[model samples]
Target: MRAQRGLILLLLLLAVFCSTAVSLKCYHCLDPVVSSCNMNSTCSPTQDTCLYAVSGMQVYQQCWKRSDCHTEVIMNLLEVAKVKFRCCQFNLCNKSEGSLGKTALLGTTVLVAILNLCFLSHL
Candidate 1:
C-alpha cells in the first residue's frame, strides 16, 4: 500500500510538471529605420509577435506591427517567434510578424495534444 501511494504521488507530480512546462509566453520584435521621406510621415516600423500556450496541450501564436514614427518613410521589418515541445515534433508551434509595403501585419498559429485521463471527472 505504501509503494502504491508513492507511485500515485510521483505520477501526480509528473503530470503537474508536464502541464506547466508546456504552458509559456514568448515574444519577439523587429525594427528598421527608413529615410528620405516627409517629416510628417511615420518611419521605422516595429513588429511584435507573441505565442501563448493554452489548455488541452494546445499552443497559439499571434503578431502585431506598428510604426516607430521617429522620422519619416516607413520601412520593412521582420520578426518571428517559435515554440517546441517533446509531445510534438520539432518546431511544433511558431509565429511570424513582418511589414508589407506600407502596412503592418499580424499572424497566429496553434498546436494541440489531447490528454485521455478521467482522474478529475468530478471537476
Candidate 2:
C-alpha cells in the first residue's frame, strides 16, 4: 500500500539524517583579542567542549571534552598566581572573536531538522 511505501521512505530518510558529522572548532589567543587568535583546532567528535585558561598574564583557548576540562587549580609559582580554567559549551564561545557567531549554529540545526521533515513527508 502507499502507506507502507511511505513508512519505508521515512525510515530511509531517518537513517541518512541521523548520521552526525559534527566538527568542533576553538580559537587560541594569549589575550582576549579577536585578531590575536593565533590558533584554531578542529576537535574530534569526542571533544564536545571548549576551554579558556587564564593565569597571571597568560591566556589560552582550545577545544576539550566534558571530562577533560576540570575545575581550576590554584598553584603558586615563585611570584605568580594560580591559573584559572573556564569551560563553555557554545561553538567558539571561548574565542576572542566573541559569541556573536552563535546564530550560525542555529541555522545549521534548523536545516538538519528541515531535511528530516522533508524526507518524512516524501515517504
Backbone clash count for every predicted candidate, in the order shown: 0, 1
RMSD of each: 16.6, 5.9
Q: Candidate 2 lDDT, tens digit per residue, 1-123?
A: 666766776777577544422566666555644446657777788877677776656666777776656543212321225667766665566754354356457757886896676567665
Q: Residue 5: error of model 1 in Å?
A: 0.9
lDDT for predicted candidate 2 compared with the true structure: 0.61
| Residue pairs with backbone atoms closer than 3 Å in model 2 (clashes) | 6-123
Tell me which residue pairs clash in candidate 1: none
Candidate 1's TM-score: 0.23
Worst 10 residues of 2 by lDDT: 71-80
Q: Model 1, 3-93: lDDT tens per residue?
A: 5655675678678655534442232222123211112211112322222222222332322222221112112221123333111111212
The candidate that achieves the highest lDDT relative to the unseen native structure? 2
TM-score of each: 0.23, 0.48
Q: What would you estimate as the lDDT of candidate 1?
A: 0.27
lDDT of each: 0.27, 0.61
